[model samples]
Target: DARVTQTPRHKVTEMGQEVTMRCQPILGHNTVFWYRQTMMQGLELLAYFRNRAPLDDSGMPKDRFSAEMPDATLATLKIQPSEPRDSAVYFCASGTRGNTEAFFGQGTRLTVV
Candidate 1:
């Protein structure tokens, strides 16, 4: 009964708008990841947090993207001044240490015009 869930599965936005995406990770999972999938990126790891603390976010665009875990089951990624180049599928995944199987949400497909 536990699974990752994402909101606003599809979004259409104009350039320079603020976009918010939400994720609910599976229960009891300690690691959460944010990824962007596109023709150019091919499922790039954008950011991740372990035990509610961010481990790495080097793949995320610092100026426009931010990711955070406000609680055990919730994670969020926000983009400000979203550009056409940012249009892609954003996914959230969760897993435990040394666990290769990650549970992924359906993803939020953003189309920036």
Candidate 2:
């Protein structure tokens, strides 16, 4: 079975740095989601796309977070001007909304100093 894969499972950076995390969603899937997990925010939805079209990103911080689907199987999330408050486990998930179970990447644990 195909699965979503992520790179740089762990990342550490100082404040005001740029961080990019990559994800390869399952083949033939068209929906992708970015989520941040923390004790305070819990599991919060950052952004998502369906069939390469952006759906909603109201849960994300507009100034520092960006999510995109550049191709069928590739999705990426980037953060600029990162701060210590950005430390969290960033997860990439993909699925057919309302149809199948979402597949999650191993996750990129980002820590900003």
**Best-fitting candidate, scored by TM-score:** 1
Every model: Cα RMSD to truth: 0.9, 1.1
- Which regions of candidate 2 are displaced past 4 Å? none
Give every collision pair in model 2. Answer: none
The residue-by-residue lDDT of candidate 2 on 34-111, one tens digit each, is: 889998979888998999888899988899988888888788899998999999999999898676678899999999
lDDT of the candidates, in the order given = 0.93, 0.90
Task: State the lDDT of candidate 1 residue by residue for 27-98, as single tens digits.
Answer: 889999999999976999999899989999999989999998989878999999899999999999999878
Count of backbone clashes, every candidate in sequence? 0, 0
Deviation of model 1 at 95, angstroms: 0.8
